[model samples]
Target: MYELSLIALIMPLIVGLLAGFIGSKINKSFTHWITTLGIFISFAISCWILIEVFLNPFLSFNQNIYEWMSIAGFKFLKRVF
Candidate 1:
């Protein structure tokens, strides 16, 4: 269970990197398509994650990847209790 959750967390990152690498190697016309495909794939993964979380409400996703706390000394840690 833990391992599956971990994979869920990491899959989008791996896909993004793989798609970016491929896009960089391709021509300009295909680059847009490749990057768009990557974005679409990531969006699909997010939708799947949302559905999975809804189905299994006990599993918690505690990842906080945004760094918006340092803007004008705004503290996020205190606000998210």
Candidate 2:
């Protein structure tokens, strides 16, 4: 379970690094498109993960990435489930 979480975290970092590296080597116009596409892919994967978790709660996992300072005594946090 821990390993799976680690992999889930690392996967995005790896994709970002690879996209940046490849984008740097390409033309500026094309680089923007590549980056946009990467974001779309990530968003699609997130939606899919959400659907899977909704369909089968027992197999789902959640992670809290970070928190923001409280606003009006209300804390803000980012999480994945």
Whose lDDT is greatest here?
A: 2
Off by over 4 Å in 2: 1-25, 62-81
lDDT of 2 by residue, 1-81 (tens): 545445555556766777778867779787666656666666666666667767887885667779866799887888876
What TM-score does candidate 1 get on C-alpha atoms?
0.46
Residue-wise lDDT of candidate 1 within 31-77, one digit each (tens)? 66665665676667667777888899887756564565675887564
Displacement of the residue 25 alpha carbon in candidate 1, Å: 6.8
Q: Residue 24 deviation, candidate 1, in Å? A: 8.0
lDDT of 1 at 7: 63
- List the lowest-lDDT window of 10 residues for candidate 2: 1-10
Against the reference, the lDDT scores of all candidates come to 0.64, 0.68
RMSD for each of the candidates: 7.1, 7.2
Deviation from native of the Cα of residue 73 in model 1, angstroms: 26
- Judge candidate 1 against the unseen true structure and give its global Cα lDDT, from 0 to 1: 0.64
The most accurate candidate by TM-score is 2
